[model samples]
Target: MIIEELRDLIERHVRPDMSTPVEGVMIARDEVSTLEASMSGTVMALVAQGRKRLALGDRVYEYGPGQYLVSSLDLPVTGQFLDAGPDRPALGFGMLLDPAAIAELLLQGGAAAMPDGRGTPPSGIMVSEAPVQLLDAVLRLLRLFDRPRDLAMLAPLIKREILWWLIVGEQGATVRQLGLAGSNLSRIAQAVRWIREHYAKTFHVEDVADICGMSPSAFYRNFQAATAMSPIQFQKQMRLQEARLLLAASPNDVAGVGYRVGYDSPSQFSREYRRQFGTSPSQDALQLRGGELSLAAGLA
Candidate 1:
């Protein structure tokens, strides 16, 4: 029932660009089944209606109403609404997770929130059930969209409440490390950003590891654990994703697009593109030109 209400509210306020009057909050509506390619910034994506199926590396995650997904790292992501359509489109609520805010909560809560027994490194992304309290907080937050005058004064409080819930929820550890400075995930987060920035350039793992305050061996292990992809594989995904976006815009210049994204050999670019997207660059470009676009979750 709460989700039904959430769905109605989202449908009413959802925009073509998936933005809202409230900063950091977005509503997503999708009517297609096509998989989309994009970067997953640190975000909280809660499904109010329908389902979202996302793929990262070899891992596939699918969640529906009353569930939510969070990613603490900026990683290459590809996914779609498996059950969306024109009549009953998929709807979702998304918000960026501000590290400073989480850090504040961690500082306020002290030790319980900052446990020393962090076991296996958490993946950059995680999904879990939404408790009623979290959902209610979000409900109240969205309700403020209609009260623009009260928004600036009250939005931060409710958003903080939502973060509080997430900090204490099932995926708490992941969110907690997102705020900590020296945590393995935080270090890897630095590396993820660096990789994204220089995705096309040749670089050594040791150099990146050095930048993250990690040794090459430790950094490689943590990076793989968190992203489910080796550094090279992650970079390749970025390259292909950039190329796909380029192809969508300039359908006729496949070779040039490849070269622009840092591929030296046109043949290698075509081979990898087909392997990544299951189609040659020119063919995918034609479809993109013919009104086909992967709607990678509206908020992405």
Candidate 2:
């Protein structure tokens, strides 16, 4: 009953017309959306109705109403809604978590409440029930849209409160690490940032390790723990996903696209691309251009 009410309220305020360029209002709708393989940011997603599934590396995660999911670091992922229909669709709200904000909040709150010991990597993903208090806070935050002036004045305060709640709540320990400087999660986050910024360039594990302030062995172990993929595997994902986007946006030379994404040997690129995407780059691009491929199936 609560979930149904929440769905109605969300659908009322966060309609398609309210979409934003950066951060859109969250809502529930009945549509079979395509699965996207892209870099996921640190986000908090709560499901008020229906269900959703996401695949990260080899790990798969699913959650439904009253449950929430968290991604503490960026990673390539395949995500789709499993339960959305005209009668009862998947309803959810997601807030992007900013590490700088979280760090500042931790400093303001003092060191007393911060967890002790080094931060470890979570399994790249985690899910838990959304406590009533957290849900209540979320509802109140959404209501702030009606008070446009107050949104500018009090939205930051409320957003900080929500982050604080996440820092101290169950799995709060993992979220808290996002703010720490030298933790494993922080290091992996550094690597993730670098990968996102320079996805078009070719880089080695040692270089990424140096960027993260970890030795190759330690970085590889920790990165795998956090992302469930080796550093090379991660880069391959970025390259392929970006190539897909480039192909979809325009008719470009397949070999040129591969070169742009940092593949030196076009033959090697074609081989790996085919292995990952199940088609040669040219064929894939043609299929996408012809609208013969559904994103969900292509991603699968």
Candidate 3:
């Protein structure tokens, strides 16, 4: 079975560091891990074994073998392996999405491959079934790890093929917009970047709207539609995620960490942190220190 072969290849090659000789490619494995909150960037994740769940805003997405998840924009997300064990670990492959590569393919294929005007607006994150062609491309990409001599010459070509398959898949419209400079997704991505860079500061909606060249109402609607969170909510997520990172490093200075991340009151920070992570900051940090939590859980 292709799934079995893929899982075997991953088990053989996946490093504890989650890196491969192929740049921007990684494999993940976990045995009954806990749910973790973190931020995800633009990437596609294909599950080869077991099941995983991700929570984004109010949406919950679950996928197992033969399915994939695509996060087209950066957003805070809660994710975990739903089912796994030492005997049947949750395994997955992930690759960073490159807009430049997608744009190159779009140019070679011409405008006909672009999304039509009637196409639906793209969301920030999406999940779709993995088609046979996509699975084949992914398998070939992983196989390159075994052929060091061919990796240099063939890896780029195979990666391009994988992106092409994604662009033509069921959620192709969303993937297509990712490469178009003037598309709504691209414009919203600019706004997302701004909010991320200035997460610690408060800003007016009109200001961010102007940055994206949209009216405040339109920006708010599109932002929510794309990210499933309001601007304030998005900022709060960033702040909280950053705070968690800080707390992991300096577990004793909870109040200082809260103030540094833009919270005015320690009680308010503790309350929101608990709301977002299901535990107080100090307790979460202690878990992190004790190895009960995995820092890599937040990363790809």
Candidate 2 minimal-lDDT segment of 10 residues:
17-26
RMSD, every candidate, angstroms: 1.5, 3.3, 1.6
Which runs of model 1 end up more than 4 angstroms from their true locations?
Answer: 111-113, 116-120
How well is each residue in 65-146 modelled by candidate 1, as lDDT tens digits? 9999999898898888888899999899999999899988888888453574244468888889999999999999888888
Per-residue lDDT tens digits for candidate 3, residues 1-300, read 889989999999988888889888888777866888777888999999988888889988888898998888978888888778998898889999998888888889874756642332567888899999999999998998899999999998999998999888887788888888777788788988998899888899899999988889888888888889999999999999989888888888999999888899889999999998899998998887777876555232
Q: How many residue pairs clash in each candidate?
A: 0, 0, 0
Instruction: Give the range where candidate 1 is weakest over 10 consecutive residues by summed lDDT.
Output: 111-120
Candidate maximizing lDDT: 1
Better of 2 and 3 by lDDT: 3
Residue 136's C-alpha lDDT in candidate 2?
Answer: 76
In candidate 1, how many clashes are counted? 0
**Pairs clashing in candidate 2?**
none
